[model samples]
Target: MDLAVAHILSRVDVQGADVLLIDGPSGAGKSTLADAIVENWPAAEKPTLIRMDDIYPGWGGLAAAGEHVRTRVLEPRSLNQNARWQRHDWTLDAPAEWHDVPSALPLLVEGCGVLTRASAALATVTVWLDADDAVRKERALARDDGAFDAHWDDWDQQFARFVRDEDPVSSAKLVLRAS
Candidate 1:
């Protein structure tokens, strides 16, 4: 996985011509990989990043959030227009703010469901990450500090359905075992 990201970084123009999507089930190290990429990226060519976690409506809004990202972010970005989308505040259980996604190239979209077939077609590269289920569960719980305990199973189920339907890994340019 490290080498894959490194290779992708080497090929990036860094002057705004790439759009990478990193998708995987929860605890599959998507965020970690995203962070690594950004950290290693040249400071002069930093890309805009959007985490699906921020876009999701709630614990049960995975499918809807995926659609939201497609319609509100990726589509408009493809047309070279600002993407207008709402951020759902989990605590308030409502739309909290409107984000005007800048016309930035080399965008990095990272999270589960971020690399659907439709979105993948628009990306310069797509990476799919995976890990053992037990490892994923342990990592997720530890990261969230038990706050995600009740929602873990629900999110996992959604992830399974998403993988079954989207087959994101099959479409990816890189498939990584993040374990």
Candidate 2:
């Protein structure tokens, strides 16, 4: 674990007003960092986590998924209300499950498009993680057990477009090189 990561994790005061967004390219260790934060969080704080992968429509629905999360989850949550969004079932190729997100302070959202310009304004802290392309490809495919192999190139193209449009790293509070 990076010392900076540990420092950030320790400083997160969930009981107070806080919303952490972890965003990066696929296989950049965004999810891993988010998990570490959640794990190190005080149990009494009851931090809530929302993963963009679960909300994403599909492999090709990256842009749509970002918009969906913004409208469905972030919008409502900002007003201190419980929000609901259907989770896409990848295997079934449809949304087969409903996720009722409780209104929890200091919410942690982690994924590729979680830190767009609009979303960044809502987050108290945003961390961007990135790794080399070869490492990213290897980690991503292995993590998904080859399920994302076919879509790798397509997704990478979309991610590049998103980076060009949003420049999420520039908007982030911290940028970490995750190896």
Candidate 3:
């Protein structure tokens, strides 16, 4: 791993009460960075993950159908350190029981739409990871099992809209070079 990059990343100070946003195109190692931060940083200083999907119903959802349109954002009061939530199972399309999601003092809301409208302006620190389109596709494909042709195609379209809105380089406090 890149120890230098990890050290640099650890130094970022969140601007305010809001947690940091790791904004990057898909497959730019968003979760990988979060995992690294958790692993490498001193336990006290490590930023725990507050996954955007964890706040939602399932793993692969921004919003479900008309009934549940980003419910967590609508009720931001419950999202404190003592938040009680059970993330939806996107693949199953079923609601789960309420579980306590301790609000980690320094959290990483890492994902594509994380930098989009819902959570964008609330970010304390916005770190954007830069990589070209081809590289992104390759990385994503590798992560999605062997060859994820259809997944990559759909992702390309979705990501275009997502990136258009976020434009992380323009939006983030710091744009980090991603390998």
TM-score of each: 0.94, 0.92, 0.70
Q: What tens digits encode model 2's per-residue C-alpha lDDT throughout 1-179?
A: 55756867765676764778888999988888888888877657756788889877888888888887777777888888777777888888898777877776578888988889988887788898899989999999999877899999999999999999999988888888877
lDDT of 2 at 141: 94
Q: Residue by residue across 1-179, what tens digits does model 1's lDDT show?
A: 57967887876677775888899889889889998888888757677788888889989888888899888888888998888778899788898898877766578889989889998988888888889989988998999878889999889998889989999988799888876
lDDT of 3: 0.57
On the 0 to 100 scale, the lDDT of residue 51 in model 2 is: 89
lDDT of 1: 0.85
Ranking by TM-score: 1, 2, 3
- Which regions of candidate 3 deviate over 4 angstroms? 1-18, 43-45, 53-60, 63-86, 97-99, 146-148
Higher-scoring candidate on TM-score, 2 or 3: 2
Name the weakest run of 10 consecutive residues (lDDT summed) in model 2: 1-10
Candidate 3 on 32-139: residue-level lDDT in tens? 776776566554555556555444443335434101322343125225535444556655768865654345445566666566544545555677776777887788
Give per-residue lDDT, candidate 2, residue 8: 70
TM-score of 3: 0.70
